[model samples]
Target: MLDISVSAKLKDLVPDFRAGVICYHHIVIADLPQIIAERLPLFYENIRLSLEDHPVSAVEGVKEWRGIFKKAGTDPSRYRPSQEALLRRIGKEGRLHTIHSAVDLNNFFSVQYSIPLGIYDLGHLEEPIRITVGTQEDQYEGLNGRIMNMENKMISADRSGAFGSPIVDSRRTCVTEQTTDALQIVYTRPSTPAEESRRMIKKIAGMFTQIHGGENEWKIIE
Candidate 1:
């Protein structure tokens, strides 16, 4: 079972912060679609087509995320939430580097729902994935190899220190082609609700079931 905990420190800062999590095991990530790096044009083309039908309206959670970022002593305009960042790119560039199916699905959901989502390889994580406030020493290397400091912000950490946040994630728990056991998290803000979060999970789950033709062996994340 995955042990998920939230600290009062984080609750005090963003009391409405909630996450809806789902776990999927025994995925055949290697057998999924290829062309990860070469699919940027395709993704952009799709986004462009959809932008006409579904104009890139500001996601409802964006305002709350901006406030949360400000409360955390971070610049909301500079360090945008993951979903906001993706939406900006879609509205402007509409391009994303190709990642495998799992990561790609997360991106799809991010842009679709305007929520910050991350999939972490459970195989790489230690138990007690605690959600807590960041300290001065809680810096971790992002997947892009840029070192980010997490002072006065909410962070998700395991035994190895912080790895994920509402803004950016670390490379240590990144999902890859070899990832079979994974935990997907939809980070919610005050502007988000449980119903909306569940819809996001359901959409991703349905896509996985359709594409991979496999079942998710989910366990309780108590």
Candidate 2:
């Protein structure tokens, strides 16, 4: 069983933020072989092209700024463009290049479909994991114990704390060799219509199954 927990402080911070302002979703799966075989290469090519043509920006919302600015506190205005931006950029360029299998697969789907995707070790999560918006005082430990600024970021929380991110990931729920099950979370900004976002998610989910060859389960909530 996956052991999980969420910070009460974090949960309290959710409401003031807008839903779908950054369209995001989570996908949980049990294997990776097909992802390696088919999707990896395609994703690599897409990344290469994107890097060549459009210089990679630090994905807007992921960046840090002075305190207490926007109502979301983090300036949702400059937040990174949805995966749609990456895909459109790729289309304008031509083709892209592949990276490590895992990274490549993520970039490929994210760039193609226009959604931010985060994959975490399910084994590390507590069952019935939750998706919630972040709050002001909410914080998670990141690389080197650097506190992850959850202030206004949308997050995937387990029993422990924030595991997935719109900015960065927590060391506790990060993917590792020991990972057996995983949850792939995708975020969509408010600018995207719900219908369009759902369709894009379904298409990407189907592609994930086709390439990875695993039993898949999906859920979407607003």
Candidate 3:
């Protein structure tokens, strides 16, 4: 298990924050050529029912994230909730991207629970991973070559640098075809129930086992 920490400042800001971590070894993330074909409709129904008649922004999870962004001094509109972004796009487009088993599992958990998750290549991370606030000096590359400056924001970092957070993840630890071990991370805001976080992690672990040939070891670190 990795050593995890939460700062006093972050705890004050998000008192009810809950996190669950799952580390899987001997995992194989397949191309999953048939996964999208078989599961697209299920993903759609999950989102359609949850997002019924409500714009993405008004959903409670999205609203909580917006408040988190505002409190962290970032524009909420600019940094929309990551899961909400995925849900909005999938709900509108009615399609899911093929990123392989690990990535697909991540998105499935995210949409089902209305909480963003990070699936990282476990082999790439250093020990003693932590969660804390980012200062002005902190910066890392995010999705699609975007360099994110983590100022006044909650961040998850290893000894090397920040790799994952609710909003974005660094490219250094992204899961790809060769990945044999993965770390699934779920972060819940104050309004989210601890039970939901637990269920999300459990479900993700179960999927990973069924989809890929792997077993998972999990933890709930504050």
lDDT, candidate 3, 42-132, per-residue tens: 7676667666677788877778778876765667677766788887877677656767878877877777677778889989999788877
The per-residue C-alpha lDDT of model 3 at residue 13 equals: 71
Give the per-residue lDDT digits (tens) of candidate 2, residues 1-222: 222333353335433222221111233333456636565456646665555655444433222211112333455445433353444445555444443334446666666544566766665777565556576666878633788777666667766666766555687876654444566666554455677767766776666655544545554544
Which has the higher TM-score value, candidate number 1 or candidate number 3?
Answer: 3
TM-score of each: 0.82, 0.58, 0.89
Q: Count the backbone clashes (under 3 Å) in each candidate.
A: 1, 36, 0
Q: In candidate 1, which residue pairs clash?
A: 36-98
Which candidate, 1 or 2, would have the higher lDDT against the true structure?
1
> Which is the leading candidate under TM-score?
3
Taking the tens digit of each residue's C-alpha lDDT, what string does model 1 give over 1-222? Answer: 478777777777766767767677777674345444356467667866776666544446677677777766678777778877777677677676556777777887776666788788999999888878789999898876899898876678999899998788999899888877888777755564566656656767767655545555332221
- The local distance difference test score of each candidate is 0.73, 0.52, 0.77
In angstroms, the error of model 1 at 168 is 1.5
